[model samples]
Target: MESAIRITRETEFYQGYIRFKMAVTNESPYAVNEVTLDFVYDDELLRVDRYEPLYVEKKGKLHLGSIDGGKSKSIAVYFDPQMCSKGTDIECNVAYKDYKGKRYIVQMEPKEISVICPIFRTVSDINTGRLKEILERLPHSESCVFEVLSSFDMFKLVNLSREVIEKRNVKHVRTLYTKDKTNYELWYYGKTKVNDDNIVIKLSFLAVQHTVELFAATQTAEALTGLLADVGKDLKVTIESRVTGKGRFNLHLINSKITGNTINNLLDQCNMDGTCDVNIVIDNINERTNAGRSSVNNTNFLNEQEEQRLEAEKQALIKIEQEKQESLQKEKAEKELLRKREEERLRKQREELGRIQAAEEPKRKEEEYARLKKEKERQEQLQKEKAEKELLRQREEEWLKKQKEKLEQIKTAEEAKIKQNEAQARLRMEQEMQERLQKEKAKQELLHKREKEKAEKQLKNKNASTCQKINSNNSKSNNKMLMFVVVFGILVLIVFFAIIPAASSSEQKAIDESVKGDNYYNQGNYDSALQAYDNAIELDVDNSTYYHSKGTALCGLGRYDESLDSYNKALDLDENYTAAWTGKGYALNELSRYDEALVAFDKAIEINSMDAQAWSGKSEALFKLGKYEEAQAAAEDALDVRSFG
Candidate 1:
């Protein structure tokens, strides 16, 4: 036979109820007989009293009255978990006995049990008699006696609870002892019952400490006896208190006296024992009421009175602070109300202003149009006057050109006349040359004779080699001076033409490219316009306006990434440029980088809040990021700018 056990939580922790189930399967060879199922668990922290049983087939059939081998039956168990906290796990075991008197333990998988603490009170029927009052005072001391003796600090008593004792695992229970006071040991007791359906479980606990001098006197002992008898009628308190002597001191209720004179009689009875009996009840009352009264002095009393006054003053200060806070809150609320009213009034004024502006816009535009028409006519007139001035200047240039041509012709004619005069002079000089040549021919004949004679003399008297060397040296010096002048002239010309022109042309190209790109961009041929703008930037990378224009063109082309890059370039060139920041935000929004777009928009707004495009772009980005609230507010902010669409 197969049997299964199931543990389930019935009620929550506060209700203290838990339930279980048992099931048996039938597949055995023998005939079925009676079987019993028992559910067991750890009843330490919590105890269960009753459980319902299983009812199988009727009339003692094959599977009735008991479970045979290979036969199945089901049973249940119910309990309470009154002390269990949430998520506590409890385990249960089940065993069954068949009709053949063979016991079989059920093998089943373990199940996890959870207990939820409910809001209801745990104990239903609490016996609040004399014993109950003593049990309620089980955990008595506010602070640990040992820790207080060691540290002498009262701070430990503040915010102390059961958690502190449990954390420290403090085993010693707290109780007060007095040397001069009478001994009346106050003990508390509690009891718990489990698995008893006949009676509800009630726990009565009494705490008794073992000490040498407890109830040392007969009168005190008698007082303890009378107190215990009046506490419970059927209370069975476990007494662990120590006896003063070796023998166990047992009190018989029938022999005990109950009158106040019984203490006096017990003292007299103990007179031969050399100990005077004292009333413990009176001692306990006095001890509790006059705890520190014996140590009071005049100085201490005055200090205490002053301390009380200071404490009262402190309390007054706290109350004043609380009142101040309340008043501040009230004033803040009032200020906020006034501010909101002012804002509403201002908003209405702004709305009125917007309406007025809207109503005046067309009239203003019409007047502007008339003014523009007049301005255009005036510009046309100015252009005509400029054209006439240009024509007059051109005519003056023609006259100057005619005069320059006439002067060139006259100068050429004078050059011809000078050439003619040079030819006539040359002819005359030839005639004189012929005459002089004829005379020189005669002189040469004479010179030739003198030279022959002088040569013959020089051949005998002079050194010819030295004179030829001096002539060669003079001719080389003249040739070197002429080459130096020619090289210096060529170097000057090369510097002017190559190095100077290269630098000047680079600068001129940069300026010209920027100007041309701006012209093309302003004309709105964005394709060629962007090309020109890129060319301008290539010539001068630091040109912010060129980058701005390129970014604008890229945005127009729907190339948001490139546009963002270009705008970033512009910002790098000029950090304070509002146009670049606004453009960058727009590009980021186009790419759906809403967070970055908002940051860029904020920067642009900081630079200039009147940037309508930035406002609108920020509104759109905020809307897509699940910030519909902010989006609506931002959209309203955008409409506040006149240029926002």
Candidate 2:
């Protein structure tokens, strides 16, 4: 049944958008009902679009209604991409029901699609370590977010970033307090060229630290989604993910990307926290776009002097924090030592007390042994309870991990489904286009055949009925018709081939010399070409083409004066010889005779208006004369004539 339905997909690109056309056709004996195509789309990269002959039933799905046997329907849909992306799959499901009430879904093979963006490069994942190392060493303030920078001064770009932040609605802020606190800026930039479907871009992003407080707030998951939701509020974000054994902190930023569940991989390894959360896609501030520290200005949009002042302040603060951390470590170590000493002292006292009891109550030895056994059981029970709590915590962490994996799987599935409907629509449209073309071709052929038959009938007006013809004369007419066919074939062969003429021996020699000169000229052997053309001129001095050939050969040899003489001689033989006139113009131009060149070129143009060489020569002559406007017009004429030809 699937074989009974045929589909084809066609893709086209325009200046601002891409189009996918689909054609769905039924080759079955019976009609199908309620045919539908469904798929998912990433809103961030492409926006949903509609053109003529295409109507959507709903988002991510198209209701095709019904497909009759031997019928085809087509539609075109468009995509306007906002950012570059690594390739993602969008699966399509084609489901339909037969008149008999049986439903079927057509499965299609996966297909590869290509997209081209001028300046942006698409990457699957980012390596944050390298990006962070580069950013931390920036000489400027952290608030100087760069949007696009190679074309402008650094401060100006930073000013623009600051302006965006000021005008922007801060919307919401959510921070995760992690044990690790070394946060680095991330970005991408480019100077690139994408050829065909192959995209190549190079550039890094620049951003400020104003967006994050680093480790200040203890934001619950409820307060977190506001920013993530805005990321692709109008459209769905496309994600490129990988499976790793190194996953930690459900939402911690480990990979260059920060898609997290427990910690949603948003921050780097040092930013790890013991928790779970969803994810968001953040990139470098880049050509078009990135600060924050403790007790620091939220907006580090400072001037050079201010930046220096801030840096000095930051260094002082950093030193103080380091000393504070060292003191805390020392205090912790001393406390651990003191606790161990106290435990040893308590153990000694217990032993002494136990010995004293043994001597004082020798009869109570059985009671003492039972009491010791009970104490051992109590300690063992406490250990068992501690182990169970540890195991439970491990299970909870595992559960969070499983949930994150499930979400990723769901996203992957949805991605495939979205593209499925889009591809399906494209296939249906292609089928319709092909059918229209075929019908048009057949119609034209039939019209041609009918016209040909009409002409034949009009020419042969003496209509003799076969029944009225004598049977005895049929053999004679057949013999006559056969003879006519043979005669006609011979005439056709002669007519088609009669252009071949037998030249006299001297004329043939002249042509051979001219051909030899042409081959030499093509090979850039101007000295040899000149000799051959001279021989041809001696053999057939009256031929204008030979003189023109001699002129070109002389021109090639830097003999402009001689070339001019030869051109004049060719023109003398035939005044309307356009090539000789053009050659004369070229020779005159080379000699800096702009007036003479213009006259010669004009003469050539008068004889043949479509002569591009003459137009080009005229343009050069006018340009030499400083008639800029006239030269431009002549140049334009040459281009127009060549394009038509």
The per-model lDDT (C-alpha) reads 0.46, 0.52
Off by over 4 Å in 1: 1-490, 493-501, 510-524, 542-544, 572-576, 607-613, 623-645
lDDT over C-alpha atoms for residue 409 of model 1: 44
Count of clashing residue pairs in every prediction: 27, 61
lDDT by residue for model 2 (338-418), tens: 755965775576568657755766556667789889999999999999999999999978865654453334324322332
Worst 10 residues of 1 by lDDT: 140-149
Where in model 2 is the C-alpha error above 4 Å?
1-503
Tens digits of per-residue lDDT for model 1 on 452-491? 5755664543354335555567776865675576557557
* Sequence-dependent TM-score of model 2: 0.23
